[model samples]
Target: MAWMYLVIGGLMEVLWAIGLKYSDGFSHPLISVLTIIGIVTSFYFFSRALKYLPVGTAYAIFTGLGAAGTAIIGMVYLGESISYIKLFFILLLISSIVGLKLNAKVEA
Candidate 1:
């Protein structure tokens, strides 16, 4: 359950990140509001996740997900260039996240 919260929180982080780009430095009122909401929700979920998961592991995974998701979204929707090297590093980040999860000592 904590892992779920962490993953969801990470996704929310991605959402807010993209929202920020669209918010035009908060000039777009609605987008800025929604982005703020996403940011709040992301933190809420992170707190919920911290109830069970180790702080370091959880935070690393959370930021990994957010960074990777944001990068992918930028490449796909925001006209960012897609380079093989960039993709390779993204894959490395994903692999590291998975490795951390596998090595985590989950509290029963």
Candidate 2:
């Protein structure tokens, strides 16, 4: 369940990140509102997951997932160029998150 929340939070992080591009520095009211909602909801789930997961481990995983997910979305939907160097770093980030999840023993 904690992992589920973490995944949802990561996805919300992606939404908020993409929302920023459309926000026009918060000038676009609708997207700005959605961005705020996304950020708030993302943090709520992240905080909930922290109740059962270690802070250091959970936070690292959360941010890593956010960064990687947002980068992928930007590349695919926003047509942002994904260079080989950036891809390598993103893969490294994913590996680190997976390692932490595999190594950490979170209680339900």
Model 1 C-alpha lDDT versus the unseen true structure: 0.95
Question: What TM-score should be assigned to candidate 2?
Answer: 0.95
Candidate 1: which stretches are off by over 4 Å? none
Error of 1 at 79 (Å): 1.0
Clashing pairs in 2: none
Write down the TM-score of every candidate.
0.96, 0.95
Number of clashes found in candidate 2:
0
lDDT of each: 0.95, 0.92
Question: What's the true lDDT of residue 80 in model 2?
Answer: 94
Best by TM-score: 1
lDDT of 1 by residue, 1-108 (tens): 989999999999999999999999999999999999999999999999998889999999999999999999999988999999999999999999999999987666
Model 1: lowest-lDDT 10 consecutive positions: 99-108
lDDT string, candidate 2, 23-85, tens digits: 999999999999999999999999989989998999999999999999988888889998999
